[model samples]
Target: MPKVSRRAVLALSAAAPLTLPAIARAAGPADAKFEALAKGWVDANLRLNPVGATQVGDHRFDDQIDDMGPTGRAAIIKLATETLAALQATPRAELSRANQVDAAILENQVRSDLWTLQALQPYAWDPLTWNAVAGGALYNLTAREFAPLDVRLRSATARMQKLPALLAQARQELVPARVPKIHADTVVGQNKGLHSLVDGIVADGAKLAPADRARLEAAAKTCKAAIDEHQTWLETVLVPGAKGEFRLGAALYDAKLAFALNSPLSRAEIKARALAEMTSLRATMYDISARFLAGKPGAPPTPARPTDAQRQAAIEAALEYAYAQKPARDKLVEAAEATLVEATAFVRARNIVTVPKDPVKIGLVPEFQRGVAVAYCDAPGPLDKGQQTYYKISPIPDDWTAAQADSFLREYNSLGIQEVTVHEAMPGHYLQLAHANAYPSVLRAVLSSGPFVEGWACYAQDVMADEGYLDRDPLYLLVHLKLQLRVCANALLDQAVHVDNISRDEAMKLMTVQAFQQEREAAGKWVRAQLSQAQLPTYFVGWEEHKALRKQAEAKWSKSFTLKRYHDGILSFGSPPARFAGQLLFDLPIA
Candidate 1:
């Protein structure tokens, strides 16, 4: 594993003081100081991370390239360090409790980021970042529709300018001595895609306005050079060094785990927890499957131990069935709209909480942004003034086999589709983000935690289940369980592959044999695990935390716990990690 920098460790390890200075309380013309600083922080942060900025709906730096070299790294550290100082200088008493928490979370995030940037040094040779860039560029093409062509061109140009330098840095930083074979192979596939983006998108400077064409042409040249350099570096350096182990070594893994989770649970502790939960979930699946699908009256529960070949065949069959049953593209959109209506009625009739007035639209994934997560909810930034939310779905491949299409459709059948709609459209990602966007503080929104974001979405599955949807449908229940299992499996994969020496075969068995996934699904999971960290675990963890918080809040409020009151109160705290929510709701001091 790569070693984290001493500087990063120091920044995160320091204890933050409890209160802000007196001058921070002065409500003069400088009262907007924090707000100004937040914007600046956002700008610098986004400029250094253009891909993120594009995701966040910022187009100003769309075409800019961040160095990500030692100099670039130093700038990031400085920004984080300074941001912390500004936060510390603010008087906490003057700010609302919500802002205070936001400040604290931001401070922690800055420190955490600094630590990861310097210490683990993920940028040097991390396959996750590389493949994401390669893949993310395609994804962005779909997203660029909302922006004017000129705006998109500018953004592309900026990114193109930085590509060569960035790739050069990648070549230097990626230590070929430790590259993993699985990751290297994945990158090989990704590199082909990267070249496509360059040739088809970045290299197409003629599409820009006359004024923008020259700059884009120059950027294209640079991008072409960088792409070639990185390609060579991958072939000669990183590829040769691609060993098979996934772990980032013991110490760095431990540190990353602590910061990512914001808890003291060791990898082993998390694994134990996941395993226990998986056992209970498996038993629950048996009961539920038997109760709902008792056609044979006493048939055994669905088996998990499908042999590799068997699993592949079963999944292929499932996919075939799915495609056969799927609606036409337009009908698919209609179904989603209908499901959203039903979900809204369900929530409203139950009077459980507030629903955002924001209009939600379901759309197909655009050509450029093809290989991001299968589906993602693109909500407006928290600081944005509008209420538009987009639920983007990837279209099935044009050449998908009839059987393959069926299996895919089955995985997202009517009940399963409703579950997704509840989570991503009417009341899941759309609703949560709508409320979070209304949060008074900018810092919290800018630095939102992944666990909180994903956890809320996962929790919505059960929330809808409890509220009633295709009530007691066996397949529906199976879908939910499968999703939850993905979360649990994520924690296991991170721990097993990285912390322990779990092989690809073992990982395949875990998902296919233990969790009952298909081969294609299992292979996809393997790629995802290697490419990201501290994310897959969030769905389950977030669900766990959200459940616990709601339970505690319900108990505390008792008779006073109106659904709206509880929900409004919960969301009013902004979008910090639910752990932070636990502290704020209970009036407990920061842990």
Candidate 2:
């Protein structure tokens, strides 16, 4: 549950914004100004966050890590404030529709970053900020093949040499009193694993000349020692006195939630909708459950408004079928690779959506990247669309006891793995993002919306189910419903944990009992919920937005609307917020 820093989140979703190719037609003055501002912002942002630049396939800043000290932070804040003013000063009415949308997104991005620095102030309190910065800086160079092995190794050595200074700055800036206990604990565990990135991945992968190899080995050894020293300091000095409040309180949570969601719905509205959906989705699960356990002797009849115990019993009974087909502990990655092939074949046969031809590979999640979610879709950056996309799955840690590993495998059983593959690879993130990269506007690709990106994946899961994937097997459909329940629970869990002072016991009950997550999965989510705010809710929020958009398209087009056509048209605009996508699709004016 490391703090996902601004740069890390940007790397995960939006990459560096490159300029659009110009057309032969004459341009309006405001359009020209907007285009120039877009390029300037991208360049300045990359300079400030070189690790982010590397993640997005920009090799220009490959040798540098970000400066995280007070002066460095102040410079970014000043730039954001000035840029916000400039964006506001430009007349939105004079720009083209596309430029107008970009202006809105840029303004929000600048304002959000300013809020994070000035109000949230995570750099001073969150130790995970430093941990992620160090991990990402190295991961970018080692994990991808964007450059020659020797060249990448050289960049890695330079970044490794800078680690001591970075760690020293972190030691100076962090205030023990403000460090949250959970964040401190998470970093303490994570710091122990950072060295593995250098020792295991980088050194093994990079084939350098003897002198350069020796230089890298030396720098990496020094970097590991610095990390060890920092860990000791954090445990002995920081954790003992750390008493910071983790709750954002209602006010801060509300503000941060707005920026995170980027939707018109207020916090209260989202909560209400989430609660309603939870009830509705449970009923659907029950219906599917009844069908799944139709002939079972001990199965209880599905109730109209089942009590908590009855709902749990029926859902668990249905899940037993899926859990029986769990993957072997050692074969998680192998199973996912096989699932990807099946998912791709299904998408192609059904003509559900246009599958992208970009190559995708499954890999074990790196040590530094673990302790967050179990898996993620690492699409090639927009600038590097020709490269590979990774569906990274975290294996059960070797340190886990037998029971812990078994619990994890049961939760991510065979059906669960296939469901995840469908969401992360074929006709989900991989397919959608490939289309997103092909989008004509670089500005749009760089400012992609989380809800749109996540929502499409969620939508794809449902579409696959509806199109009779797995031959419409009731077990597969039941797993789909169970996953949907998790999505709904996420919306509730995120708000409750941050704004409502939810305790670990309460959060665990919500995830395990209410959502039917395994004990290990629930525990991991408790940590993730603490590390992030307004993020868990995206899957549900985005799915709802996509559902509404599809309904609108159906009504507007009448007989002409097809799923494939609607999907392609929606993805063509890149990944904007759902509201903007709606406006763009139907030719509605940009607000």
Candidate 3:
């Protein structure tokens, strides 16, 4: 089969090319059957979630958004099931080695989506997650951070026109009979952000033409009504029934693990691995604490036994320090700009890899989407060539009390701050994603593997550390360790909350005791674990995979390898699943 060109897939979905056939050809098929299968797969995916195109900077179908109603639900599941069956039936020998891997990757994605919908059965009242996703999608469409202003507004107007229908779809699709307690509480929290988004659109209405303005206003009104109704449902039905349990239980967790990870490893195996890593990380933390406190502290730091309240205060203080340096928010963005410049120079100085000249910018997080994550690097979708990449830093809320703000800051102290910069700005997500967006095949970019994205960012932390960043400042190193511990805790909390019948208290205890998380920070983590699924674990998992792959490649290239060459070589494969990176680098089968 001929390879599916990036242009063709974009033409079909307006998103990047995500055809499995293009990727599958590397596995070995020589007939038109592959192209048909690939096109079919792409079409099904685009139809199931039209918002996906918006996220990727594609406005062709921005007017046709997913309703999130039963019709949409059934259509998606049908697509996934059918795709899985078709992919499974393909002859193994017909796939080229790379296509075999791509086939497997595509199959895993379909299975993951289906397993999440069916086994987790979370389609009830988790409006919080839905609202957050929707807000992010809209912000991306209107912000013009990725595409030109006029282009974005046109797309936003199209989406805004369908807003009411989409919300109504959500209301109808949510199973009132089975609404989960935790989901209800989350929806309540998520609404806090969604309401803000409505405000943003209304405030910016002047940007639209009169006709477009009318459509946006109507959409905004409908969205407001839907949100109000959802809130009412939460208060009357879901909250009254709130069980406060976060996890779906063991059996479902197992199914989810199989689907989400697409790896042979089971939840139990991941748990065991996480536990072992926790033990090692804890020991390292202790060693670092001892060294830092040695000779200077009044009392030889005996695990400071602070109350949960006190711990929360301390965490906020750390976050404050991390964020408060000389420049305010705008200046902070400038710092990010400087950091990226430094990052590119650092790599170039060492002759490490080619840095694309595509402009990267730093910006503050837009208001409507402020609370979701502290920072994120927004790279243009594959179809968005030569556009700016934004490193958005969400500001601390003005409404927060001084104490609350203080606690938040402490958690992100200098070292933590630097690690974050690396992850979001420098040699991490921003840089890696920039390369990924330019990958030859749009399909891979659209169907990007989560592990590859999160993992590369996580691995970049260690990459900078190993390159003697901060002069190996043990303090910085210690903070990195703490950050690593947080990732580990996330992996554990995700499982504990959903599958192991772990109570809130138990989850808090694990974070505070085992992970040294402050109470406030732990509480936030609890919410995050509830709202997102199968994603928190990727940071550590991806890091570990990248580490292993890098070591193997180093050994193989031995005398011939330069750090620059190796770094470029590793990333040049365009964010294939990490396993594929190893295979391609070592000339092994895609397995």
Report the number of clashing residue pairs per model. 26, 0, 33
Q: Per the 3 Å backbone cut-off, how many clashing residue pairs does candidate 2 have?
A: 0
Candidate 1's residue-wise lDDT over 66-162, tens digit each? 5567887888899999998888898766664455566666677787878888787776556646556544543454343547666676777767766
Error of 2 at 316 (Å): 2.0
Q: Which parts of model 2 are misplaced by more than 4 Å?
A: 1-5, 8-26, 201-206, 303-308
Task: Estimate the TM-score for candidate 1.
Answer: 0.79
- Kindly list the per-residue Cα lDDT of model 3 for residues 223-268, writing each as its tens digit: 7776677678667866776654455667776776555455555677
Model 3 earns a TM-score of: 0.85
lDDT of 2 at 79: 83
Candidate topping lDDT: 2
Please estimate how well model 1 matches the true structure, expressed as its whole-model Cα lDDT: 0.63
Q: After superposition, how far is residue 261 of candidate 2 from its true place, in Å?
A: 1.3
Question: Which lDDT value does model 1 have at 143?
Answer: 40
What is the C-alpha lDDT profile of model 2 across 290-374, one tens digit per residue?
A: 7778788888766777787788789889888788898888999999999999999999888777766666889877776678789
Model 2 earns a TM-score of 0.95
Which ranges in model 1 have alpha carbons more than 4 Å from their true place? 1-40, 58-60, 82-96, 130-148, 191-241, 264-269, 295-345, 363-372, 395-410
